[model samples]
Target: MNDSVKKRNMKVYIGKIKVMVFERGVCMTECDILIKGEKVEPVKEFVYLGSLFAYDGKHNTDIERRVNGALLAIMNSKSDSREARLAVHNGVLNPIYMYGSESWMWQKKHESGINAVAMPPLRSVWCLIKINIKTVMLESGMA
Candidate 1:
């Protein structure tokens, strides 16, 4: 322990602590984390660096949270241009969802939710292109 850490109102308690078990089966043993001779509560899930972690090693909750955030980003954008919306979707929202996607296990419902969130901006781009193509063809007498 350093004086600077104490001055910052931070205290590090060290003592015997129970090890966490990560497995497919349910944990059957009773265990507790102890610090400074005090029992520290166990947590089921925690968020770190924009990713959600669970004791059971599931990503569903985190994926849902990311999806909602992306949808909100789309909803909050003020630009009516399809290109602008696409930019925000690709630049701001997609990275959030795809950050740790390589580690995620595939679930039908989660996949559906991700696909649904991704559809709107793509649809907007399609519509914008369709309208432009129609206008160009009409102007060129090729409609």
Candidate 2:
């Protein structure tokens, strides 16, 4: 590792080294990894590059976090025009929820999860409280 770093003229920040071990679908807490005689701390989960990574290699927590973030963005936005709010939903909220999505393994539950969170904001944008989701999606050009 040191030789590769030297060859690439790259520096490894020891303070940022972390170890997370997964075995047989379970996170191991007893494992100790050492780098340059320094003990690397083990973490159950951590956010790296704006995406949450967990020990079990599941995206549930990350999905929940993204949903919450998008919801917060919707709640904080003060646009009175439906067009402006729609733009915010398509621009800001979509990116926030869909970041790093290319690497995600598509699942039925994930689609349902996204749709469940997507409706309320669309409803708010269209000022419709009792309309069907299909109408909302069609009107918003999201279907």
Task: State the C-alpha lDDT per candidate.
Answer: 0.55, 0.69
Q: Candidate 1: misplaced stretches above 4 Å?
A: 1-21, 28-44, 49-52, 62-79, 102-110, 128-143
Tens digit of per-residue lDDT, candidate 2, span 64-132: 566566366654466556687888778777676667777565567777777777777877777767879
- Give per-residue CA lDDT, model 1, range 91-132, as digits (tens): 666677567766555557776676555555454544443345
Instruction: Please tell me which predicted candidate would have the highest TM-score against the true structure.
Output: 2
Write down the TM-score for model 2: 0.57
lDDT of 1: 0.55
User: Candidate 2, 126: how far from true, in Å?
Assistant: 1.9
Highest lDDT scorer = 2
Clashing pairs in 2: none
The list of candidate 2 runs beyond 4 A from truth reads 1-10, 21-24, 27-42, 47-53, 58-79, 100-106, 130-143
lDDT computed for candidate 2: 0.69
Candidate 1: worst-modelled 10 consecutive residues by lDDT: 134-143
